[model samples]
Target: MGHHRAHVSQGHERGGGQTHEEHSGSHGHGGHDGHRGHDGHAEVFRRLFWVSLVLAVPVVALSPMFADLLGYTVPRFPGASWVPPVLGSVVYAYGGRPFLTGAVQEARARKPGMMLLVALAITVAFAASWATTLGLTATLDFWWELALLVVIMLLGHWLEMRALGAASGALDALAALLPDTAERLTDEGSEQVPLDALRADDVVLVRAGGRVPADGVVVDGSAHVDESMISGESRPLRRAAGDRVVGGTVATDSTLRVRVTAVGSDTALAGIQKLVADAQASGSRAQALADRAAAFLFWFALVAGVLTFGVWAALGDMPDAVERTVTVLVIACPHALGLAIPLVIAISTERAARAGVLVKSRLALERMRTVDTVLFDKTGTLTSGRLTLVGRAAVAGLDDDELLALAAAVEADSEHPVARAVVAAHAGDTPAATDFRSLPGRGVRAVVGGREVHVGGPALLAELGLEVPSELGEAVTHGQQNAASVLHVVRDGAVVGVLAVADAVRPESRAAVDALHAHGVRVAMVTGDAQHVAQAVAHELGIDEVFAEVLPADKDAKVVELRERGRRVAMAGDGVNDAPALTRADVGIAIGAGTDVAIESAGVVLASDDPRGVVSVIVLSKASYRKMWQNLVWAAGYNLIAVPLAAGVLAWAGFVLSPAVGAVMMSASTVVVALNAQLLRRVDLDPGTVTGRAADSPSR
Candidate 1:
């Protein structure tokens, strides 16, 4: 991990992240148009590998030197010797084209890498083998080695190339989430049309089991929208008139006519896709370092090959010296080293997307593993964003129904969350009233049933100098302790009833907090709610810290203060007022994924409102880093040992590595690295699995 650590250290100095331009320029991996080029390389190398391997079988078997080394005999035939020379040449020209051309590009750029090393080894072997077949030099007959080298290098690259395209697979999956066409509502009736033909304000008829054509508000009808592709919620959300629905989400149970507010790039699907593509293009800091390391390996192997030839020739064996040099150069494939980090980064991002965690920045993925504390914005993050009527109480003269109806009538004119909850809770007719007036923090004052009635929190009770009677005091205290928004109802300045409006905690919140805690992360809650309320919710969720009554403008100060205390903080919020704080934190985790604020304010978006995505990000970071380290150590170790052995360092012990053995080791190392990186996809990041038993929220 020495060189791997160097990569991370340099990344830290550069803000623990890198740009897409730097990744491409530094890698100079022939083609750098993100994964598009990688996919091309994968297909090319896969074909090259299989063809070269087939041709190598004969070239290897027909070689006298190979027969002698392996104690096997080939049938004496006139054309048998020609088989090696002819097939080997074809293998070099066809299979070696990619590496040879790639080496030329690197040479022109004055930056060499694995391609140059592989090219040099095969060129030397091809030249020497032909010469020996014509009796030009002794002991330079290595057609078998040349053929195998090309085949093995091709195989190594083929495997690495496939792994590098993992990000592309995720991108394609995202694109495939949308339907090919949509039903548009027109004056003549609904007609099928392409998404591109649709415009803003175009009404789309989404039938049961069809995806929403665009981001819009439901104008008519109701349905359960499954936004799992965008929001990561497995369950379909109920959608009704005036409710917003994102494009690409499914209308699961009923039909809905939606008024399109956004199309094309403005859709949430487009936004999420762009964020993902941007992150994938950047690559990981370690991948950039590996590219540099590959360049270094090329120079290292070249210098060592020259030294090996010089020493051996000085001992009076020019032909064997050239072969030994060829062995050393080819032994340094560098494929494993080249793949060590990038493949891990690619697979991690892919897995993150599947878990509803969109990693919009490599630095966020890199730093999440280091986070020791998480600051959560309370209201819309831990709790459902909307207020629901939870409990009600009444005075001796009125029944519960009458009290609720009176309160609803008074609150009908107000649009406050508390008022909405009260109006939504009332099942019977609410009496009409006029003389509606706003009291700001104190609550609303309106004429209900021709009597002046008031509704508000405890502040309104204090302003009116009214104490809660013993009949409703118990419920009021209970509501206050649970952080429920208690609204006091008054008639003609006298207390009449009370209602409890609560933002019920999401069922996923407890599991998320528990999982973070299990990972040794300290959970803290920050909100504009009062101390008592914040503390009550914090206690219920088992959070370790609580910062209550925090104004939206001061949220960032809390993040800055925590970071100044030597704690690595990750701020997860609703991405509204918490934008500044999110930008200030070491890692910004915007809880709501598809929201513009979430996408713009944070480095990481939870595409779903589930808090467990925080854990997923951390888990993926650590897992990816572990794979990077594993691959680096294996590749570095293989090069270290194989280079010396191939250079005949162990010849005195009769344990020297032949060129064929070196080629085998190179491909094996690459296979090992790719398999290890692929293992990341096996990581279970589902929020439901976080704590094993998340308590369910009772339906209202």
Candidate 2:
């Protein structure tokens, strides 16, 4: 299983009959506020867009230039001449307010962007149109162009906000998983109470098909729990008594009485939400590059607009100069460039979160694309970390069952992991043992049915100076050669039998290594286990490199050695000893079931204990980076071509762009970038099907 971080929220009583409030940690991205707050901004832009569109119709119809271009004459009316200027003024003030305010914010920060470019273009158009209306100069009227530009810009912003809202819907979906009320088990039966009223140790009844009110363990009954929302595992897992059930999961088929272990912000769902928010807020190298490019473009447009106006005015008339300059500024707004990277980052992070791949570092995610090697820690990461009986041998008269039972009876009261494995493997009821004694760093001793029995490893055998009989000696040698820990069982100071124990390899580890090879990434193993043990596992998984018998503190040095060979390495581990190596690697992936120290040091955390999640990380990294480049190339290329045309470069061929038409092209470019980022959602990330082709490849 992957590393899982457990958190518990503090409980408090409600005052004045009010329901207890659920408090979540403050996310850097402002949690739901970052998305919900945009609702008002989107609504304002939407309302202004429609209203501006309505007011622009008369302005376009009454403008002399528009009528002349269409080969028509304006109909004379009592108030027709005043309609264009009055409505154009209203559109500029009302519809363009957001852009005006945004420009001010950017200016105050000394980093002008798309908003400033837009504000400059419209302000010039507004001033020039009123200049013509008051007879200040005989220039072409710009009232119609100003009105249309505002409406188009407003429409574009509204669509952008809506797309952001859709991407952030993941947070809302997570929040909705918790039920408002819970059925608390009480003395008189079950009583309904608010979800926030649930405290740790409170037994709650989770009826069939009901959401688990909080993170807890099953106390009574059994059920299949659908944890897909929390763990991204599609199949419902059978959860019996003492099984942990996270809040927001559903008990599908049977009712369960669960003892609440955590509530509110302490739940796993809350942590996942916080991770998503943090990833979105984190800055990346690519984003910084995009920001720099946008800042440059802002100054470029400002200077180019000035140069275009000065050159045209010296060579021609002021009217043509104003029109060309306005077009230049409008077409070079950098709207697409500014949004290119941020949009891709937002969508990709949300997509990764939904797949149970939590990205703690944006830079590590970016680095995953170049990884050449994947180094996995052996214990608990690639293996189950639980000892299993692999081989057994018995003396002449003692059968295998008789030998195992004797060992189990002696170890029944010991708290060592190996002792538990022995007891678990025994089939029949264990004989009663009394006066149990634990030998520190050795094994255990107990009186089983009035016979003094002792179970220990090689140390115990040497201390007692009792040699293993030839019949069991061969088995002990074979077990040692195969990297299994053999325990010598002694009854009444005489060696009786031997049992071999080894940590079992997980079924997913082989597939995980094979998948990495399929992606052309070399796999390596690092472990503090003995050379024979580590090598045996490496050979089984087809690992290319092995670093065995390394101390926990020296694991990071192994990662450094790989890097010194010019290898871009990714490390996957699940222990406190793995923390240094995890941090030293190019990309550190912590198993969801790993320790907190390992998790904190990792750049990515896999929610499932399955090793296939490593493959998912690589796939997502490649896909997300591809989208980022596609957007950058498009945004930069659009400006390269559009900026010159808007400056009247093709006027000699009778093709000059008006400010209104320039605004349309700019908005279209922004829409294209947004749509391209959304395509990342279609990439297949399901761990089950993710490595199909890898499994069929020849072993390296």
Candidate 2 lDDT tens digits, 120-146: 767888887888899886654778778
Tell me, by lDDT, which candidate is best. 1
What does candidate 1's lDDT look like per residue over 1-700, in tens digits?
0111111111111111222222323333333345666677678778888999999998989988778777888878877779999999999999888777767766887877766766787888888788888988766677887887777667766665676565556656766777888899889888999989999989999999988878898999999898766654566778887678888788999999999898888777667766766676655677766777787777788788888889889989777697788778766767677667766776787777766787888878998889999999877688776677888899998999999998888889876656777888898988897899888657788897679998877667777899988888898889888777778889987898888877777777888888788889999988777677778788888999998767788999999889999999999986766889999999999986553622677889887677777887888888888887898889878887788788887777888787666766777887888788889878876665644544353312
> lDDT of each structure?
0.76, 0.75
TM-score of 1: 0.87
The number of the candidate with the highest TM-score is 1
Model 2: which residue pairs collide? 1-609, 2-592, 2-593, 2-609, 3-591, 3-592, 3-593, 3-594, 4-592, 4-593
Clashes of each: 1, 10
Candidate 2: RMSD to truth: 7.9
Global CA lDDT of candidate 2, please?
A: 0.75
